[model samples]
Target: MIWQIELIILVLVVLFGFGALATKDLLSAAILFGAYSFLLCLLWAIMGAVDVAFTEASVGAGVSTVLIVSAVLRTTRRTDH
Candidate 1:
């Protein structure tokens, strides 16, 4: 059961990675990156690295996402056309 849960999280992280890269909108991509980081935190916690998971959750998902979203809000989401 634990292995199955880990497997699903791993898959979700991979999917989020691809989705982040594929998204054209900066906000959407940033959100997908946050989701990827969250899944990565889960993976680390499951692997007995709770400290690393906590850091990843707080820094990667929280601070970085907020920074990215704020930057996106300040600027344009679309590229030069």
Candidate 2:
């Protein structure tokens, strides 16, 4: 049962990772990246690496998302094809 749960989490991480990379909008991408990071943190925690997971949550998902969103705020989400 635990392995099945882990597998589902792993699949989510992969899907979110790809979603982040594939999105054309910067804001969407940034948010997806944050979600990806959060999922990664969850995966790490599930694997018994609580310390690393905490760091990823605080740094990867938290601080980095704020930074990226702020940077986006200063600019625009428009992309010129």
Judged by TM-score, which candidate is best?
A: 1
78 Cα displacement, candidate 2 (Å) = 3.1
Please list all clashing residue pairs in model 2, or write none if there are none. Answer: none
lDDT tens per residue, model 2, 1-81: 389888888999999899887887889989999999999999889888999999999999999999999998888785556
Question: Which candidate has the top score in lDDT?
Answer: 1
Off by over 4 Å in 1: none
lDDT of each structure? 0.92, 0.91
Residues 1-81 of candidate 1 have per-residue lDDT tens digits of 378888889999999999998888889999999999999999989989989999999999999999999999998995544
Per-residue error for 61 in candidate 2, Å, reads: 1.0
CA lDDT of 9 in candidate 2? 87
Error of 2 at 54 (Å): 0.6
Candidate 1 minimal-lDDT segment of 10 residues: 72-81
